[model samples]
Target: MSSITMVQAVNDALREEMRGDDDVVVLGEDVGINGGVFRCTADLIDEFGEERVIDTPLSESGIIGAAVGMALYGLKPVPEIQFSDFIWPAFDQITSEMAKMRYRSGGQFTCPMVVRTPYGGGIRGGHYHSQSPEAYFTHTPGLVVVIPSDPYDAKGLLKAAIRCEDPVIFLEPKRIYRAPKMDVPDDDDYVVEIGKAAVRREGTDFTITAYGAMVAVALEACEKAAEQGWSGEVVDLRTLLPLDEDAIIQSVTKTGRLVTLQEATKFCGFSSEISAIVAEKAIDVLEAPVKRVSGFDVPFPYTLEHVYMPHADRVLKAIEGVMTY
Candidate 1:
């Protein structure tokens, strides 16, 4: 095991996968020479060379369009969009081309690609950089959505995503990119299965469901809830699409109370889907209505980012509300 940050673990995953598979390639702006804006791809160019670890133009659509071609030709391409906020330019390519390739071709062609993007606020990136747009990708039918909250899951999930045959939207939480180190397994074959939720904390009072950067906030709120003589079972939803409905329901059923957390806007956020799932499938076991703690509906603010992004205090309040309901 290695105690490493998420960025290091991600670089390790890309290196390990690229070493084992020659068909796996990474392409994005500054991903090769500059090692990405967050340095997640540091030194990859030296190891894999420019051909494998490609650095493309500052065009998201071009990046995705080229990845779509690469995938169609039997190569697994992991294209980073620089930031989630900048992904809008490639929305058509992602939603129409990359995502629909396998189905449109009737299984004759599979788009084996992973669109990696850093997302969420907390880095003071202002409106142009900070955005949690996972909901948009999650709504796309043929795309697999994944978000890892820790170093271990980040490495394992990225490895799994690269190996997957279908298109995958891997959302990396920028807020927790350099979070406290964790002991990630040294094995190259280690993989955290997609479409499964990991329970970060076990409790009987309530279930606090979240993913990506919000997982940390949820855990912090859980700890605070414990101080208040309450227990919150924190669930990290690593995968969004093909969701682990059973795991979420099991946690909600066990706790009989639910509170969802997300850094995205409250209206139509991924948290709303979780809330709906619980309401439809586990309503009989509910001790209260599912409370969603999310960012404001307005565009991601610049100066008031701390106030806009959902944090431990906001989640703690939702936990208290759900428990007392």
Candidate 2:
């Protein structure tokens, strides 16, 4: 085991996978000699050379489209989008080509690729640099959406995504990329299963379901709730597309109250999907209406970035509302 930052853990996973699998290649703008904008792919070019660590032009569409082609031809491509906010140019390619490859070809074709991008706020990046767009990809079928909150899950889940037969959208929370350090397994075979949810904390009073950076905020709120004699269980949704419905339902059933949290906008966000699941399946066990603490329905602001994010205070307020109801 080794204590490292989320960025280091990601680097380790990419390095380990590329070393083990000759088909695994890393490509994106500034991903080669420049080591990516966030340095997540740093030092890879030195070890793997330019053939495997490619630096493409500043075209998101081209980066992803080429990855799809490579995947179809038997190469495992890991493309970096730089930032979630800049993934729009490649949205059509991702949603239309890569996602539907398997089904559209009647299982004759498969794109086993992983698209990595940094997402969420808290880094003072305005609208252009910071955005939580996981919902857009999660809504698409045949794509796996994953967001990790810490170093351990980040490394494990990323390794799993690279090995997955389907295309995986790995959204790394930039906010906590270097803020917290944790002991992550250094074993090359270590992997966190995809489509599984992790329980960060255990309680019986209420449940808080969150993912990505919001998992930390939810855990902080749980600590405050304990002071008020309310115990809150926190569930980290590792994968959003093949959501662990059983884990969520089981958590809500025990707590009798649910509070969904995310950094995305309130309307039509991933939080709403989880809230709907609890409402439809666990309505009988619900003690109060399922509450959601999410960003307002507006563009992320430069001056109000902190205000726009759903913090511990906002989550705590939602917890109180649901528990008191």
Candidate 3:
């Protein structure tokens, strides 16, 4: 029961986990002494000392590769890639090495590491700093993909990710780092289970599904629709991997229509997976075709960022279209 910013929530999670478990260590470029490029790791170096909280060279591969070694040696190392767009250089270490180590070694070696990176666009970071790379890791087996929309989930899920015995790609929507405010649980151990979605609003018209920064947009649209005599249920999908199909199916069953939104490109995005689930299992219950309101299927541009990310207007328009059908 304490209102805090998303950045502060993340800091709390890291601090709590590091104090709770001696095996937990943080590694990445400028994460220690410099406190990260985004300042998420601020004051951590002063609190945890250099051995447990480390700052390395500007190399993503080196960071991931070293985490793999550390994890195999019984240390839970969490690495932060300054931006999601810059994780490509470490894709091999993530997808090929960290992800499959436990499986290849027959549970003899577990890569319990968390790769955190800021994703999505709204701060005019263009393409290099705002790519949503969750879907990329979602496609890779043995990797857990997670995205939190608010302060509470950010703190809870980060603690859970640090404890889980797998490689987790924790995507933090940079836009909402300081945007949404909520009173997180005051309990010392308030870990939210990954893969569960939160219903932000309750309605029977349709379910607007979203995650990360887009969750706030969907909530805003739902509020506006309520003022206009329309009702819509808003779902905040906290995790991307090990998805809770039961919750999604239950929401769509009640609403009879579903609209999915994301900040990433539309083609083969996370929405595609959710839509396929509804089509495969709940087609008869759907009142209308499941629609996707997402970023255009093209490289994100600096000049057209507003056009690239889904906004409340697009979400409401999609809701209106679904209601008509």
Q: Evaluate all candidate structures by whole-model CA lDDT and list the values in order.
A: 0.91, 0.95, 0.89
* Best TM-score among the predictions, by candidate number: 2
Candidate 2: worst-modelled 10 consecutive residues by lDDT: 273-282
Model 3: residues with Cα > 4 Å off, grouped in runs:
none
Better of 1 and 3 by lDDT: 1
lDDT of 1 by residue, 100-145 (tens): 8888989998889999999989999999799999899899899999
Model 2: how far residue 222 lies from native, Å = 0.6
Query: Positional deviation of 245 in candidate 1, in angstroms?
Result: 0.4
lDDT of 2 by residue, 49-112 (tens): 9999999999999999999999999999999999989999999999999999999999999999
lDDT of model 2 at position 199: 97
lDDT-based ranking: 2, 1, 3
The backbone clash count of each candidate, in order, is 0, 0, 1
TM-scores for candidates 1 onward, in order: 0.98, 0.99, 0.97
Summed over model 1, clashes come to 0
List RMSD in Å for every model shown: 0.9, 0.6, 1.1
